[model samples]
Target: MQPDDIDWNIINILRESHQNNNSLARELGISEGTVRQRIKKLKEVGILKIRASINPDVLENQQLATIAINIGESSQLEAKAKEIAQLPGVLNVSITSGRYDLFVELLTFSNKGLVKFLTQELSTIQGITSTESFLMLKSYNRYV
Candidate 1:
């Protein structure tokens, strides 16, 4: 199925439950093959990903923190961000347009683990000038 042929009802159905392809197709009055084809095309074009994501809060030993890092050189932004993304606890990284050069979401099992990550790992990165961290105390809305 082509992008233009994709109905909003199909999108709604998919959003509601991507796993239930046959149910979605039946509700939208289309064949399951059509839904599968569209989903495949969407995945091919980098529009969709069906992957499981864990909630860190569910894991009692884990802690999540958002750390904003200021960089010394704009030229090293991409390379530095990529390096930070590879760090053990680093879950997500984004280069943003603000006072900080990059924002990183990290997860660690203990205070020592997080401190080791920030002081030993993150501090050694070439372009990083400063880091400000905010520990997530509580969450009102956890869904991504």
Candidate 2:
């Protein structure tokens, strides 16, 4: 989905206050009705999707990790990314440039559960040459 500048500006403001159309309108120097209309159009055109993001720290027995992976082959990148996307505990996967072929984000209930996902579920997929997992200790300025 492609979002224009105004849409992006609206998005930036909305990220701070998803529920306050009046505040968004004030920030954008537009009317609340216009802000509402733009948001509706954005959602209808599939340029935007609104969802709630739960902070893992608020809950007990929860953990978040990011895994950078290097693949064995270029041809298998898309399929490998898709396979890893379906693995348990995996929240999102992206094929990236530079140092890593794929970046996978995951959340698990416990450290042992994360280990099982890394060793068992991730091992099930081939052509993954290496993986480096980083556990999130804390986050500053996280955007929803």
What lDDT does each candidate get? 0.79, 0.86
Q: What TM-score does each of the candidates earn?
A: 0.80, 0.76
lDDT of 2 by residue, 1-144 (tens): 687787899988767656678888887788999888988999999877788877787777888889999999999999999989998878899999999999999998778878989888999998999999898877665522
- At residue 31, candidate 1 shows an lDDT of 95
Q: Worst ten-residue run, lDDT, model 1?
A: 1-10
Among all candidates shown, the one with the greatest lDDT: 2
Error of 2 at 124 (Å): 2.6
Model 2 alpha-carbon drift over 4 Å, by segment: 20-37
Clash pairs, candidate 1, are none
Per-residue lDDT of candidate 1, residues 1-144 (tens digit): 345546456665556554578887877688999888887777888766666566667777777889999889899999999999998888889999978989999888756778989888898788788899988876654532
